[model samples]
Target chain A: MSRTEAHPEPPALAPGEVRTRWIVSTPPILFLSLFFLAPFLIVLLASFQYPGEFGGLAPLLAQGDSPDHGLTWENYQFFFSDTLFAEIFLKSFLVAALSTLLCLVMAYPVAWLIARSPKGRRDLLVLLVILPFASNFLIRVYAWMIILGPQQALAQGVNWVLSALGQEPVNLLFSPFAVLVGMVYVHLPFMILPLATNLEKHDPLWLDAARDLGATSWQRFWRVTWPLSLPGVFAGSALVFIPVLGMFAIPDILGGTRDMLIGNLIKDQFLGVRDWPFGATLSILLTLAVLGLAGLATWAGKPRRGHD
Target chain B: MTRPSPWLLLAAGLVYAFLYLPLAIVVAYSFNDSRLNAEWVGFTLDWYRTLFNDGEMLLAARNSLLIAFTASLSATVLGTLAGMAMHRYRFRFLPFLVITPVAMPEILLGVSLLVFFLQALHLTLGMVSVILAHITFSIGFVAIVVRVRLHGLDEKIFEAARDLGATPWQTFRWVTFPLILPAMAAGMLMAFALSLDDFVITFFTAGVGVSTLPLQIYSMIKIAVTPEVNAVSTLLMLLTLVLVIAASRLDKTFMKGAA
Candidate 1:
């Protein structure tokens, strides 16, 4: 079916049958302008202004007539110049990347299971993937705390097994590794859902044809299935990785104090120190990074799905 | 595609285990009589009783529900209009303007909204700002959902209605509204859930004056994990699971009818 297209102009309205698609469209546009775009623009502008002790925002707009107030790159410089902030940024990127990689590896089989399973069972399996995620994310992370805490059964059991082998016991909590585990657990469903969507439409007939041509299972997968599923892989990775970068809740609850992520830094800036200007700067930069990655994902998801 | 191999089955099973292990622990620990360990100090209903009487937790719950319902209703209305616009008219930048919020990190949104509320609008950081923030981000989800439903629409039905002497409003009320109702419900459900479970954006935008369930729970966790918090978490999980399952069933029935 053809899509419902917006008329360039109402052709000619009958006296009783008035048409105002433009008017119909106004509410959302105005809402977006008021709530989303305008505020976002303010953040962009605010990030460039000079920062003060508590918050750089006051000097910029709250006291506009003050001669000392002007645009400066100092807020950005503050974040970049500090090695601690730099390390945090790097760790955020690294941890997000690693989590995405782990999710991809773990998600493939689950996606395949849901995609290739009996049609009647597909929705149930999909719901299973989404259920844990639907629950409060904080609760899920809390669950991990219980499992990974030093005195927990799993941690102690692992430690006991190691000691039995005459090795040192592992400290699982408050570590970067714990953060990674939390991230992977949280985002695995995201990776699987998109891949399952892409894979569900993949015809089993291709495998039969490849086998008829004497292609092995691995060869058929590598040659046909692998290439066809790339869009889903890219899409899912973007969904998983970007959020993982922004979500510091897992890291905060699970990660140690030494290595902070960007999310943690932003929280510290805004909530802890109450520095609005510098926080806005960091947030803007993080927003840009997320946008870049989202663009890449869209670019990758486009070539295959564009026609559909 | 014929059948998954043994390794694939095993790996998928492991993923399910990994996903549920934490949640299962939360439920199991809610009843733990012991303070912080898995010693199984014997199961007790004391935590549930504590949660019952916690005035702050109850207040936070009420606030979360109010914001969720209000935000979801408004987001659905606004998003349905936006979705209709995209379907009927060709706006050049609607997708970017509408969807960027979804792609934007929650922290940035919180920070931007904070600046906008405090500096530009001169509004206090409180419940009003939190609702607006939730609505702002949530419209994207509703828009996307409604858009998908719009795409699945059979344009011929609308054309047929117009041909049969139905006016635009009459045709929409008689035909289009009925068709998209389920999708709208799905969108509303998702918006409600997103608002309820929201943390990162809510955290940043919510000044000290406002405490949603998440913020309240966060402060509680920061202090220490208590059995009461575990009870709250369990109840929250139960609520979420029910809503999500209901939503999935709705979508399934909707799709079946649409097909």
Candidate 2:
């Protein structure tokens, strides 16, 4: 009757047994440490170094103006003083949050429908949802350029329709709205997949039970479905929000020179301004902020395993 | 369960149309005889011929393939090892370290790698640098997938193998590897697609002369949007579609196995 009865027993490790697990793991650990970890440490170190007049690493240590070696908060000071940094950071958060909210609003209904669909149509629906993600991201984003361009068929068509309606042509491209559209389009699947998976795993008996107990539809959703699906919502939001926050390509390609996000600022510091220290500082701060937000989300969405 | 809602169906259809319409237009325009992306002059295979005949595009395609193949292979191996270690061991900081790359944005990773190469390492950007950067991000993805598959694996199989006089390596090769192979394959394919499509990291890490497909497309789009680019995009999209279908098939098979 039990699932365990279907399989044969297997032996356990002897008492006090210790295997050489580190040998298999050390290579990857060392690789990540040297390449991934060390680079970030170097960036962190460089953040303290002064920026030269030519926007290179300054010889703060050589000047002997500061204690120990080259060190200065001038780059951070500059970034703080420049209101543009705060504006860009705030804009980045706003875009990511709005995109996340949009994805949740749109994806939940779709995911719920897919989860409740008949067996025959479920696979087809799932495939439809996932197929777009398989395509090259850059190509897909660029496809938006063709769709949103002034001379684009869709744009022109919309313009003609507006003209027929005695209204002005809509300018949807190269604006914050365009950026949001692209971001949500690109990230919608990330929100849907986790939500659908979790919803599919959820039992309908609980909802039926609630309905049978004289609960309204809203009460059933609030009492049974919503609490159970919180984990999925948390996961989907994190998946969508984090990448949207760090998105550089969507805003760059769609918003053009008019818009700037934290990603663009970081990129500009490194390439255009050649201020590696400042860029590294910005990147580290952004990474920490993301990590903090993710932690907060997970804590807030923690499932009460034993309560139910 | 409730019957199908017409409103829900309508919303789903509209969303699908919105998602696929742009891609459909690109594919349709690829066959247009016009050089510009705006007007579809007439249907012809001229753009595809142009895509094939262009030496630079061909070279870029080859480079993209080379980079994706090499990076995905190395990432799969390294990621499998890392995933297994995390699943089986109690090493402190293992979880944090493995998922760090996922949190960091690709642009930052690309820029940091560029800085590290130019400033600290004194290495010029080239194929090797691109591959290194690709591996850096791809490893996290592969690790996550493999770890998920490993989580569903029964520990008893490995214990049985070990008890039957099999070495650790043998146990892993015969039992663990086979069990997680589907996830590993899916991960590798996804990594390949990601590496091939990568623009930002490759853009930064590629040396002055080297050009990948995405890099070529980026530069070309900057100057002008051409039908040949559309042709190339169509091909890339088809290729990715095939890979995704294959991955999903493998996913189904793995799920069946688990069931």
In Å, residue A115's CA in model 2 sits off its true spot by 1.0
Model 2, B1-259: lDDT tens per residue?
7664687778867777877887898899999988777877889999899889999999999999999999999999998888887777656676566777766577767877887887678887898999998998888778877877876677677777877988777877788888899899988887888799888888778968589999898877767788888899999999988887887687653322111
Listed in order, the DockQ scores are 0.59, 0.48
TM-score (chain B) for candidate 2 is: 0.94
Question: Is model 2 an incorrect, acceptable, medium or high docking prediction?
Answer: acceptable
**TM-score for each predicted model, relative to the true structure:** 0.92, 0.90
- Which lDDT tens digits does candidate 2 get at residues A1-308? 13223434334534332454766688789888877888778777778886666654666456545443478787688879989888899999999999999998888778888899888788788778878877777778888887788887778888899999999888778878889988998888888887887889888887778888999978977878788888889888988888888888788888968688988888878778888788888988888878888897789678887525
Q: Considering every candidate listed, which one attains the maximal TM-score?
A: 1
All models: lDDT?
0.82, 0.80
Q: Residue-wise lDDT of candidate 1 within A243-294, one digit each (tens)?
A: 8998878888888887588988888876788776787788888988887888
True lDDT of residue B246, candidate 1: 69
Question: Candidate 1's C-alpha lDDT?
Answer: 0.82
Number of colliding residue pairs in model 1: 3
